[model samples]
Structures are given as structure tokens and as C-alpha cells.
Target: MSELKIVDTGNELRLLGMDEASKLLGIQKSTLYDMTMRRAIPVVKIGRLNRFKLSDLEAFINQNRQEAQS
Candidate 1:
């Protein structure tokens, strides 16, 4: 069997586990899990584990950004 390795390109595109993702979003891990279950968030499935892309999460935040009323 061939072993798979992850190569870092020095970009902001790193896979984050549930704990890191939740902390980055400042939300509960359960909430992040729920979001993934509901397909409201982008996720990467590795076996039975859930992984998220830092860039994707940043995009989610950007897409959800709201401006103050003038």
C-alpha cells in the first residue's frame, strides 16, 4: 500500500479538525458538527473524521459578513 502525505504550500489552505475549526469560529464544537450534518458548512470526510479547510471557513465568514446600517 502506498502512504499518502500532506504537502504544505505555504498558503492558508490547511485542514482543520473540529476543535480547531470551532475555536477559529468562536462557536461550540457541537454547533460545528450540526452545521456539517445539515450541510450548511463545507467539510472534508476522511474515513469517519470531519475536516474543514481554513480557506473555506474564511469564505464562509466573508459570505456571512453584514454591513452596519447607515
Candidate 2:
């Protein structure tokens, strides 16, 4: 099997687990799942798991902020 890698998007970091991803967004896991179901957030799916990148999360936040400001 191939190894999973998370390269620097200008910063060193690894892929985030569901727990970390939810916490990063300051939302509960259930809420995260709800958002995913609503297609409000992007995710990386490996097999039956969900993963996220720090940069993508940041960009998501930025995009939401812009939308809210508009």
C-alpha cells in the first residue's frame, strides 16, 4: 500500500483527522458532519476516513468570510 503524505502548503503539517478538523472549525463533530452533508466544507476521503488539510480549511474560512462580508 502507498503511504499518505501531506506536504507543506508553505508550512509544515500533516493531514488532520476528523476530530482536529472539527475542532479547527470550532464546531462539534456532529456539526462538522452536517456541514459535510450540506457540502459546505471540503474533505479528503481515504477509504472510509475523512481527512483535511490546514490550508484548505483556512481557505474555506476565508471564502466564507468574504461571502459573509458581501
Candidate 3:
């Protein structure tokens, strides 16, 4: 068996571009852009472009996750 390790960058977090963000979220770029326009997705404004933090995207996924409890 092999050991698994996660690399942490301390206070530095990686940011993703629109293309990468859309792919990670499994949505079309247009859809993501539309969501951003409506403030449905979390994003950061860099000049005139949109930027997404990987951590924020992860949180968004968790926030929208649905599970049934018995």
C-alpha cells in the first residue's frame, strides 16, 4: 500500500481562471458566466476578469451538496 499526502501552501491559495473553474465545476463556461452575472457563483474580480479560488469553489460544492437523512 502507498501513503497519501496532501501538500499545503500555508496562507497562499491557488486561483483558477474561468476555463479551469468551469471545468472543475463541471459546467459550461457560458453557464458559469451567467451564474456569475446573477451572483450565483462566488468569484473575485481581477481587473475586468473573474477569478475563482479553489477553496471557495470547494466550499460552494459543499454548500450545495444534498444528502438524505433517515
Best by TM-score: 1
**Candidate 1: 10-residue stretch with minimal lDDT:** 1-10
Q: Give the Cα lDDT of each candidate.
A: 0.84, 0.76, 0.81
Model 2 weakest 10-residue run by lDDT = 1-10
RMSD each, Å: 10.1, 9.1, 5.6
lDDT of 1: 0.84
Off by over 4 Å in 1: 1-13
- Looking at model 2, residue 9 earns an lDDT score of 62
In angstroms, give how far residue 10 of model 2 lies from its true place: 9.9
Candidate 1: tens digits of C-alpha lDDT, residues 1-70: 2322334476666789999899988999999999999999999999999999977787787767676788
Worst 10 residues of 3 by lDDT: 1-10
Please give the distance, in angstroms, between residue 17's alpha carbon in candidate 3 and its true position after superposition.
0.3
Overlapping backbone residue pairs in candidate 2 total 0
Candidate 1: the clashing residue pairs are none
Off by over 4 Å in 2: 1-13, 66-70
Task: List residue ranges in candidate 3 displaced over 4 A.
Answer: 1-11, 68-70
Model 3 TM-score, 2 decimals: 0.76
lDDT (Cα, tens digit) per residue for candidate 2, span 1-70: 2322434666445678889888878899998888877878888788988888787787787666532243
